[model samples]
Target: MVISNKSNRRHFIKKAALAVGSALLLGGSLLPASVMAELGEPEKEELKFGFIKLTDMAPLAIAYEKGYFEDEGLYVTLEAQANWKVLLDGVIDGQLDGAHMLAGQPLAATIGFGTKAHIVTPLSMDLNGNGITVSNEIWEKMKAHVPMGEDGKPVHPIKADYLKPVVEEYKKEGKPFNMGMVFPVSTHNYELRYWLAAGGIHPGYYAPAKGDITGQIDADALLSVTPPPQMPATLEAGTIYGYCVGEPWNQQAVFKGIGVPVITDYEIWKDNPEKVFGMTKEFTETYPNTTVRVVKAMLRAAKWLDENDNANRMEAVKILSKSQYVGADADVIANSMTGTFEYEKGDKREVPDFNVFFRYFATYPYYSDAVWYLSQMRRWGQIAEPKSDDWYMETAKSVYRPDIYQKAAEALIEEGTLSADEFPDFATETGFRAPQSEFIDEVTFDGTKPNEYLEKFSIGLKGEEVIK
Candidate 1:
């Protein structure tokens, strides 16, 4: 049904209601009796969701296109917003029911970093969909320092150590080394900072307590915000030397012959969590069943995205290439979505997990993921003051609602829509992964110990250290 047309939408709804009535009479409702009893009919049937035009917003697109939202009795309208701030504001002011948000948006909002609101996420959208790219000139200069393999190509997982000399060269010439990230609290920002610091370059600090949120307090590289879609153009115009963003923007750079992606977030931190499906706490409380239903539909969409070794990825890429979706060239969107990522012009490599939507329990909203973002916030001075380990745990619990996710997963399993093996065993699940140690710098991260995690970083705030 073409939901974009008002007449067709009304017809679709009428047909859907009749279909449900017929199923009930035939003792074959879409959901099993037990599942239906557990999750009542949705309190609200219509919803409008917001997202940025990045490839990671695939789950929402897939849900709407594949009719998963309709399966849960939701008529969802997916709108692409201008930028992250506008998207967040839409949700805050009721202009949007929910949105595809940076993993840190809800946490940052709840903690009163930029805006104060109680935002929550029941589902993580996708994982490992971002890369750091540099302008062609920067890559040309840095290539001299990068180690080449026997194949005469640069070695895999190109470390920022190779870029340090280039940054130093710019410093020697008294030129400001500037880079771009999608937002202050975005994974792109933290990932870029992590790469730079690992190479002995300071990405700088944020001192909100001293009213300095520039995040370039004591820096070697000045990182600023540039929306994802504008990344390639901004680079071509030489407005920024490099940027960390999600596809197909990174791939767009390669296609435009303007830049080269040095490393993907997958290389920085394997299977790192990315975007989340965010809604205000008030919306969830006022319409609990609607919230759970929304999750159920997205779970189905996420599963479809990663099932059969990503067999559906090509179709997803086509949908994303639509002007209303990611709005990039099909080949460019397929470059990363199809399991291969292009670093340089002809240096494409297999990165099958580059844009994970469901495999590895990606949709589950783990508290550990929340803790990681919170730790980065504190590490970068977004939290302003030192927070206790218990405080990190409390904050993570408040924002990442695994409880809501569990309900949706269980309902899907009970209805035989998804199998039990596809999910983490809720019986033994603690909403935390085992201590993660896959970072590019070889630093181990134990989510339970946020302070210790911060202490391990050389270029970030730690303990009682404030930006004095």
Candidate 2:
């Protein structure tokens, strides 16, 4: 009888050990001698984290399913929330310790944009795993302007200008065209707006100051925030003509035959940062070691996702396909999860970096990346007022938290869980990628020279320019 109760007995002991160890190791730096002991303390060992159903949430899924969290002395329960907002709410209200979050979530929360909190991320989840899709009706309308490849599919990086005629036709017909993005401050919002504006279509502006939340004024395609998982259903219901969203969701649209993804953000900006694992500033301060441990687990998962030329991605897709994770079919998840993306059902092409987790410094939190989002916020009037270059730099530092990230990464290196070559050389890194000139319009962006780069854009509010 006693032996039969062993499972419950062991569970209780693990919890007791975690609580006792966490109390002792809360602030102890994870030096090799200390982490062995520190690993004993979870304060609370059983955790429930939330994520929206998207492939970019793979780090958290991998960390949990692969027993990496357990290796760090953490027993996790990965729950798929209904949407990003509910998932974010769970983290803020203490229903979750942490979760897969938007890159802008920590920034927006800290800055009091949507919610008032000081959320911070030590780990960036991935890079370049999003695409803009259009309903089959819209794609058919826009098809005429797109140049064809020899095989007869529309060309790569299909400019939104091709859709301008269709939008104009809608306008002439007294109809308003609608588009969907994941969130108000999401990378999808900025990327879609950037692509549309670059193609000379007014993706519209936000006057949050006027109490009008409808981000559509003087717009051809009125863009609004729809949670990622609902994107396909919403498009199918004809609520939106198309939407920009992350993987599995957009790919779901293709599988369901509701829409077709036309262009990926990799085609928009090439290896742009996506989601991140975020925690509140208070959580970080109170559970410093725990936070580091969490980061360590996630880092290992991220590396494994990208290791040996994405050897783990197929396995990751299998894990992600479970009902508790992304909850999509394995084929839908693999459409973009394993290094290639499809457009128009059969126009699949190799995009090896589409869902990068750890490779190419993807996990590092860079001020330049923060500043780029800031620039977009200003461009679209979300900031509500003009801000100086110094303001951008300071705001970036406040949200990005590169210092915290470096500490966590170094601990992993010292623990021998990862190699030094996996990260940028801290002594020599400038936190900026070289000027990238891969846009359809041929505009170059040097992260170090943000102001200059902003000025080069014919569109967008630059320098002392204010959106009036």
Candidate 3:
């Protein structure tokens, strides 16, 4: 029953029409005009998408499991990648048609930060699904600096400031304050750096131009890459004292009693963008119809994930835990997926926006979101050289294709799969969000003014500064 090609589709429809005595029409002539006009037949029907085994990859899984891809005339195979680099490589090599990627991967790739490839994303996958966790030993030391609420619980939005003294103590003891993030260009890296630097603890910098991509030059806290699934294990092994990663690894820390997640990214910056659906720019250009249709299917999945106040999240958890997708325990996956995030053991709090999939137009790939990642890249020295605000805007536009997202969204709207209200108003949308000022340090970010936003940071590079 796999309708992989148009010829097979035509044959199936013809046979069904004949068997059903003209009840079904060939070429869908009897379908509504809107459905008929929905993006022409997918230029390429068979697809294989890659994703890491993280909760944010849910939209891709849902699209495959719920038949959304099939509805779009796509036959998709979802494979979980070993790590971010592998996933990115898969897409670049065409072994994978696309992938659920760290928001920075495509941008970094396009700008020649790591691998040089013109990667692009037409849809963002989710938002605010990441957390920074400290090992139990680190948490115990940090507890002294963290203020307690009247309820005797640690007051939250736990700033990196609370961790500053511990970092200093480690420094005085001649111990490097080491931590883990998933990758160099990962959102985890920047968010961890952001959180740490906000607390007056330097998380170091990357001088790629000087061959110091280690990101630990002149550091107070040394951060390294640890795969997402290994965060808890790495913490337990004492290889790293803390890490920032997406779930359910953070929750796995709580479940295993090895670590405590101190802060979710939602607290670091409210509603910050996380993963994106990335493909080679060549893939999109070669199969434009297929690209739009893939976006269409994922958009529908994102809507279903958030609709009715996450009524279907437990079901999603079940699907995600089945050993082929996220494969974490159902309880661990549900810890954040079901609108609540467990920080310390038994310290589960209501963080309804922790794992945003579709609400607030999460699926639309905004230029502003791309710019924020770029700003972080520059701030942390991944970009090496300073550029004007116009360069930032142009680079974001190159990697984030909202035009393609609009096409998919409009097609969905016309086909009655979703409503216009569910999307940004295409005509008025500037692809930039209004200025945001919700970071732990309260620095405002107007995506249009990336250089200005970078200048506001006291800890990282700004202006014409280059890592020397």
C-alpha local distance difference test of each model:
0.91, 0.81, 0.89
Candidate 2 clashing pairs? Answer: 21-41, 22-41
Task: For model 2, state the Cα shift of residue 243 in Å.
Answer: 0.7
In Å, residue 24's CA in model 2 sits off its true spot by 23
lDDT value for candidate 1? 0.91
lDDT of 2 by residue, 153-199 (tens): 77888998898899889989999889999898899999999898888
By descending TM-score, how would the candidates be arranged? 1, 3, 2
User: Any runs in candidate 2 off by more than 4 Å, and if so which?
Assistant: 1-31, 34-44, 464-468
Evaluate residue 88 in candidate 2 and report its C-alpha lDDT on the 0 to 100 scale: 81
Per-model tally of clashing residue pairs: 0, 2, 1
lDDT of 3 at 207: 89
Which digits, one per residue and each the tens of the lDDT, describe model 1 over residues 238-319? 8899999999999999998999999999989999999999999999999999999999999999999999999999999999
Best by TM-score: 1
Tens digits of per-residue lDDT for model 3, 148-178: 9998889999999999999999899999888
Worst 10 residues of 1 by lDDT: 1-10
| Cα TM-score of candidate 3 | 0.95
